[model samples]
Target chain A: MDKVTEEELIGRSIKGDRRAQKSIYDALSPKMFSLCLRYTGDRAVAEDILQDGFITLFGRLDSYAGKGSFEGWARKIFVNTALMYLRKTDALKLSGDIEDARSLDNGEPPPGQQIGYKELLKMITSLEPSSRTVFNMHVIEGYSHKEIADSLGITEATSRSKLQRARLKLQDMIRKRN
Target chain B: MEDFENRFDLEVRSLMENAEEDVPSRIWDGVSSALDRKKAPVPAAVWWKRAAFAVAAAAAAAAAVFLVPRSTPDNTPTPGAPMVRTEVPVTAAPALLSEAVPSRPIIVAAAPAPAPAVVAAETAPQEMPSPETTETTVTKKDTKDQGQTAKVPLSFNKALFNKESRPKDIGRISISAGGNLQSNGSPAKMLTGFRYARAKAPAKAGITEVSESTYGMTLSAGIGVRYNFNPKWSIGTGVTYSLLSRSFTATYYDTSSPDLSVTGKTDNFQHYIGIPLNVYYNVISRNAIKFYVWGGGSVEKGVANKFILHDSSRDIRLTERIPGVQWSAGGGLGVEFAVAPNFGIYLDPGWRYYFNCAQPNSIRTQQPFTMNFEIGIRAGF
Candidate 1:
């Protein structure tokens, strides 16, 4: 027998072929989830987003423009699903003026003061969704200040200021414990 | 492009990638179930059949309520309440088509339906007994009424026997006090029923005045069910495990003894697992408790053995004795009483044989063969 091709699999999936869809999920869910974590800032949060995004993919597989890369398209879908969850839970309520957000001088804290990747997750999960999202996009996702603002429907300056404030609070928390 | 930014992104992603977090078990089940839903699409025909069955059941139950007389008085306070308007009849139809056919009649109701009579009796006045009790009374009455059904046993043998004759699925299993029956003399109407008369056998039956006794009666259980068969006849077979046993003790006179002593002593025993097959004639099936009896072959071949046991000062010694093949061939008369046209009980006096000798006519050299009896209440589908 011949090996199955990717394009054929995707086409079959669009036509309600469940096996094709499962094959696709199996092949791509882990990589797509890796990208999702950069945006959602937490593993559990990222998985929730991944599930919702896959549901959308199966429901609307017919709308693929076939122009942009499939990975890029799926990445966007995952980001949107995460944001949708945030929106439903009222977790993203950005209220401060743009001036309140500012870049801190201590952007590069001492190695020991800066929480390790694993420690940071515990702190991130504890943050309000607004703090987590800003911390995720601006610091973790490598999104520029302007991009974070545009994506979250907040001003670029506000995005920067929230990031600074979030970091400040986390630093205080780290200090009070040690 | 910022140095700190790229490192923060890396750290965040690493944290998120940690493999230690446990996923809930249901997540896998939910995902798999969702995937499975897309693969096997249920056919509309199956749904339609189920719906049709439901509708037909509802209609018939409504009709039974319109019919079947309520025997108990109106002004009675009842105890224990059963569901009143269920579609299940007291008996089940035979030859379980949807389910694998069981050897013993599987009281037909898969999931039981409430009998209108049981329900009527249940809510009659709170003074009336529960459907459970009503069901029990129905079974008890059925057990006692096997004689009436014989009047129409031949005419409505199949429908009346398997379909109409047997009771609904006995929900719970029960055991009863173990009983014994001992007798002598060969049955004239044994294998094929009471048809031919014996040539020189005693006229007043056999085994002059043997006693039917009970001991260790332990369990009692039952269930509620409804019954019906469509298009044609329903036949069923059942294996009865009654823990039934019997022993014989009598005078043993040995002229060969040195003193020609008459040592009044005896030794006899039998343990059997019986199977009954019922054939029904369905002319008046829906309500008639009439059918022919063509069963009593123990579900499988059996061996009836005896032991000459001697009581010693310290322990009793056992000497094994085997019987012949003709004795193991057991079948007999069955009479049923259909209470709800669908449910009832039966009394089977099956012919079970065991001789002192294992070989045919081998016992002729030793002595005459000793016979055993088994009579009990039978429930069918």
Candidate 2:
């Protein structure tokens, strides 16, 4: 089988070539699925968001400029799709952690216990949807607090408070596990 | 604190950066099917067809009003004054004439050259007597032949006055109670937030069928005053208390928890107190049955509402104070049996479409149209 280049595949898909569209889906679906799952925390919802993201991407395929990585552009679409699903369900509303703020500023790691990648992912899932998104974008995805606030349609103070609460909650969970 | 934060960030990135889950093969099929549906957009032809149907329905209703035989009189009835016209043949028996005219039917003027003398008879009396008494005592003797003009005080001719009316000749009031079944137009699309993945059932199996959605019954009770303007036309106004209720099962997937869904059997109840203004025309008046058509509008205030969601977790109850007032315009046909001259049993079947939305933000808000069918007894003076 001949290997089709990304540009040629995009051009073919734009022309309604089913084979090329399938090729694009095969190459990109796994990574996008992971991103959706992180945001949704449920397999069915994640899959739904993934399919919706792809539908939107294909519909607006003509709008994509060749200025950035195609994968980066696709990732942005999946993130937005997940956010919309959360908003419709009111999952992005802030939790009551602000009023229940207890000190969780432990300076040192728990003795003789190390957090594994699976445990870390579990911790992220346990946070509220709004707090989880803030934590992911600011701490892992390299978005500034201003950028997070702007994207989520919340104030910078709200974004900051959510992230602080997420960190405290994660630390409390880790200390208890240790 | 900085060291701890860096360690936590590193763990998150390492777990999330290259994480991948298997893409379900069925998803491709779903996507392709959705794409196919989008490609074939529903045309505007269906809309045009619906409009044509609605216009035809409206035209039929209008034709019915004009074609039906009308026997209602032309004068509005005054509470203390009896002024009505009867359309009985001059050669009719005096006893039959007395049976037809419950109020004092008198000839006010002589017949013109081209027209027969029109006798005005107020059918409803101030305080109506029993059918046996009314039949036995009413006489067709001319009021003027007795040397008493139309100005002869009702007190002087008390027995001549229809007993259905009060002694002073005030008109009559009728009260009724009935039940109705209403459709809310269409069910709203479900907004299930999330659903846990489950094993797929066989394609032909009907395991996923939800419960049947059904229309609900509403109850109404009212008291009204009917004033006969003429033999063929009458106008009425009344206050009614209506209790409207609808129950349905709504299924929603829980967003906060994975693999959790709830089926809510919700019962919504609303109370409205309304004043209705209506005009009725007598189409057929036989020995004991009177068939008429009435069209009216009601101004209603929502007094209270209750929403109960019974689910697997726990029942949630909400009491809402309905905001704003609503009004509806509707008409229907009615048949009344004169069990007695002043007491009758009536069956009224009508359609009432609300002019404004009721109970906004609630399930009761949709389908502002209702089909009302009521059967009750009427007592009038």
Candidate 3:
């Protein structure tokens, strides 16, 4: 079968073409599913978020104003879908100032021990839910502390504190692993 | 510490950029099935048009109340009604030169007690005889015995006298409260294509059936204000709370197995707030009795509904899919009796047809009309 263009697929999806919808799902679900896993830290929960995001994407295809890349638009939807899932599950609880937790050393890991991308991701998944979200949004996604604070309904100081606490925890985890 | 954190962030960001995994096939199955169950979008209601209709109806009613009565003539009393008669002196003949005036005095006849003294001014000239005739004029002896002035037959224009004798305008406003009884005018099919899962059956298997529906009698109460533009014509509007209800029973057979069947009964109640704009024309306006024909449209909103499924094991609450806004147009004939100057009672029989069905569900077909009868008391001012 010939591959349809993204714009054509979106138009057909808006018109409720089942084949076109399936095609859009096939093209985006892999990368979106991985993104969901990064946010949720569970394969099953990631799959659920992916399914909901795709459903919402197809349902609101008409809202895609064609001003930006469709992939970029779809990425935004997946991120929001992850956030909504977290909210629904009561996992996005913003409690205790990041400063209230005992601070850890931000020292370099013992020099000989090397950490790969896989090990770093595993370290991130182990942090508290709120800290994980703030760290991912601010560091990986390039969001400012103020932007993260507003989106998460927390204060800018809280976003900064969570990011700082997350880095300290990762340093400790990396030191222990090494 | 800073170097370790930088290294950790750099590694994780790179991992995230390259992370990808194949979506499981089962997710597609769930989505496709959900899509299959989705129905087409319902047609959107044009709210502005409905508002405009309501406004225009109210405006017409207001105008009818204030304007039409000015042009309409007042109620005319029957010719048999008692009237006061006065006699003119013979010296007044020159003043009676106009054709409308009588050259002779009008004789006030002695109508017995308890009888209205209606002067038959329309009676022909021969009926009056000559004013000087001894039989027609009161004799001097009788006038002296009664201690009253003598009366004589008078010639006058009957049409002018008839015009002047009409009853004065008795325009009034009526306030009424009534109970309305209603039933579907057409038969409705219910529980149509109802599907239930057999607990023991495999996934995606169920029983489907078309059921028979019978609606129970629905009763509504309403209060209204009516302006009698005249006795013969009026306009009215009122708000009513209506509770409509129906029941259905059906035998469902499992499609896959072909032998498993079960009978189930379901009932539902719908509550609506209906605003009706009506016009009434009295066909017969008598002293004690009146008959009128009325027609109008109503805007109704279904506020709430409840549906229950009854089986031997247990009753299950089913989700009810009710329409948000509905419009119905109807008319009827009414009869009223005026018991007092300010109070009357009435009964009305009418028919109404809903423009569309009240349910947004795909399973059931709807009957869009009802036969209604209402009775109530009306108070007028």
Pick the lDDT winner. Answer: 3
Candidate 3 residue A166 Cα shift, in angstroms, is: 1.7
* TM, every model: 0.33, 0.43, 0.45
Categorize the docking of model 2: incorrect
Candidate 1 lDDT by residue in tens digits, A90-168 = 6677654334533333655423235565565566657766877787666544467776665566777678778866765
Candidate 1, lDDT over the whole model = 0.40
lDDT of 3 by residue, B154-263 (tens): 22222112222212213567789999866442223211222221111111112121233455566689999887776567888888988776665432323442222333
Error of 1 at B100 (Å): 80
lDDT of 3 at A23: 90
Name the TM-score of candidate 3. 0.45
DockQ for all models, in order? 0.03, 0.13, 0.13
Instruction: Write candidate 1's Cα lDDT for B150-187 as tens digits.
Output: 10001122232234322432332222122323222223
Off by over 4 Å in 3: A1-4, A100-122, B1-7, B40-381
lDDT of 2 by residue, B70-154 (tens): 3432122234544342333232323345566334434222211111112333332233322222122234555433432231111
| Ranked by DockQ, top first | 2, 3, 1
Q: TM-score of model 2's chain A, to 2 decimals?
A: 0.83
Which residue segments of model 1 deviate by more than 4 Å? Answer: A1-9, A15-17, A31-48, A65-69, A95-116, A142-147, A167-178, B1-29, B35-381
Q: Which candidate's TM-score is highest?
A: 3
